[model samples]
Target: MTSAPPHQSILDKPFVLDLFAGPGGLDVAGHRLGIPSLGLEWDRSACLTRYAAGLDTLHADVSAIRRESFESLPPEINVLAGGPPCQTYSVAGTGTGREALEEVKKFIERLMAGDSDEEIDKELRKLSDPRTALVLEPLRYAIQATRSPNRGHRPYDVIVLEQVPAVEALWVRYAEVLQKVGLPDGTRYEVVVDVLATETYGVPQTRSRAVLIARREGLGTPSLPEPTHRAYEAKEWNRRNGDSAAPVAQPTLCDASVPGPSPAADDDLEHWTSMGDALAEPVGTQHRGRRTPFLVRSNYGSSGIPGRRGVRTDRQPATTVTGRISRFVVFEHLDDDIVYEGARFSMNEAGMLQSFPPDYPWSGTAKAQQVGNAVPPLFGAHLLSAALGLPAPAPEVMREPWIPATEEQRAKLRSHGCGTADDCTARCPRPEDQTPPRSTSRPRRNTASRQ
Candidate 1:
């Protein structure tokens, strides 16, 4: 079967700068849509990933970035985009004590260019420049620094913020600040966007995410896009259900009788065929035995299967790609004999579900990290390009890297052997038992407890 054609973005192209741009997924989408894009990420691994995807990635923290960099950036940057770290506001954080919210509040205040002597003093005490603070601190500084004294102008035409669902309050704070900072009235952000998957656009995943779009006056309020694919009209779909909740028509994974979307063939989907294929390589001895299946399920409903499920939604767009690799939907073969069972979708497949092109090589960083960190390039490209009024980008065209026989990957494969991961012919050799035996001594009871 032939591969899908390159994605045609539904937006006018614009120059974009992706701040805190992990792995350049957003940039790629924009680039494909005829927008010139640049990525800035703090992590070296992430920078490498962006470079491989053909983006001009900078290895610098947002806080450390100087105003000159923005001033000197390629003239095409009409948009500034990023997703700040949401650890303090994250529900999973232990730092949620008073100090956490205080820090996050300070961050929001700084983003609005509000000055506080206490925060400045705290930075001075730490022997650090307040200009180089994390989260919103640098973003605020960048905005202020890039402004021209003579022209009295701002640095960007627009800014986009993406974050976790658990941080709704934080987004509200962001919206508050955006309004105060001269964004035209009614330019507020929505914490939750109703987005459907490939089903609407003709792919197949029930993916949902929150999206926030803010722009300058000329750009106007960004309106949501319309859907192209419908569930009942597609012959591949076996079941159909209209969503009363969906503002637009929603798509299905397949049909009710069939479980999920279709799978790509060995040649088309080879990179996602096995567990190890999801990761570039292991991270240290700590991750040596941590292998994730290419298919995973939640109880028995949603799944993480390879190349089967598409994006799902009918209203807004998808959320950023995440390393929650095991939470995506799965696709099982419908044949009498189930060849790959209990499988979860690989990291690369997860990227695709988010609309990343197949030829978008995710490199440098570990596969899971790269996939998790990447913005859905398609979303970024389509959104920002439309905002810029440029043409769409062409699809990726490149050959796979030549794997030498003596390379480490090949050597390891030879040492162990390769076929189906299901073939357990070469078991992981048990290391010399290092664990100590349980202590035999009984615990002595406290005799003086009568006091």
Candidate 2:
């Protein structure tokens, strides 16, 4: 692990308070950068996974943590980081947050107007999904840290936040508000907000997230991280033949006919990582002998096309992993027949695809959801490095594998006397009998033959 250089800021040490910290993704990234982090999360399943990974955590709702309590927190805490709950803002979900965007802005205005917490909480309760209000909780903490006399009115040196791409507008609003916040010392936040594609940061999946980074004036202006990998171009596979109604078949790793996205004209960045590149050497003992050149078929339809399933070859980066990841099927071509490869991605494999350590201890139920929702630790490290004005972690450092939890860490969980079935020591259990669903559409030739 690499330690951050001594900062020139007022704080002697840097500690992090991560809100809505799901499964310690950003915390793990901070740890790699030699920064200690404490996370607040509400889900028991996520908390179990966090404990198993040996992350410091308070398994409580963000809303319940009063602003006054911020004063009592560790004084060295100078960094605020979080990825608030995004279900309502996700395009795949109900869109409650998207619909309530204007209303949420009004709440921000109220907060700016110095409305009492009780007044804001009362109004937030009436939203369709109360979770939508959680998005503003970071701003609340930021306000408390910078303006509340109870906290000595010391502004956090850095604030980093992330959410689904749909929340970019809200993050922009945050940037605007944060830049105007003046502290007692004549310092204000310098803010940057943008949508980041995870694959461009070397994560082996194509996931887009809205990110906001703020740093107090004089520390440095925060900026988005530069890409370390070529962006995945879906257009490479969308080339059409004249008069052909159907699109061309996806290319495989061995298919030399189709070239990848052209590299940037000015900078050198590695080609996008393929699923095979990440999973070529299986992580755990159970999957050590599995063969490669497999294909993954999504259980859900693509582009809202009925019966049109999405498929990706091992040579390509995976589509975004989601809570319903268990519904994806992994299979290989055996002569003319399709053979299932372990039914689907194991929990560890899914984590690996998301750039987690191979032996990262994921515990408890909804394990797939936990992995899906996590910030890819690799991406997190780059983002944090950018926000903190530190050197980017070397590619080899990011790729170095290790067991996330030590035997002592496991013992610590046992000492807590947690009797739940999803015990911390045990590997995250797979979904019950996750057999691949039979395809309803007419079977086409296997992806291997498409080349």
Q: Which candidate tops lDDT?
A: 2
lDDT of each: 0.43, 0.73
Give the C-alpha miss distance for residue 304 in model 1, angstroms.
18
Clashes of 1: 47
Per-residue CA lDDT of model 2 for 40-72, tens digit only, reads 776778887888788877655566554435555
Counting only residues 3 or more apart in sequence or on different chains, how many pairs clash (N, Cα, C under 3 Å) in candidate 2? 0
Write one digit per residue (lDDT tens) for candidate 1, span 62-82. Answer: 544543344545554556677
Off by over 4 Å in 1: 1-13, 66-76, 86-107, 110-113, 116-142, 145-153, 180-207, 227-295, 298-321, 324-348, 389-451
List the RMSD of every prediction in angstroms. 14.7, 8.4
Alpha-carbon TM-score of each model against the true structure: 0.55, 0.82
The number of clashing residue pairs in each candidate reads 47, 0
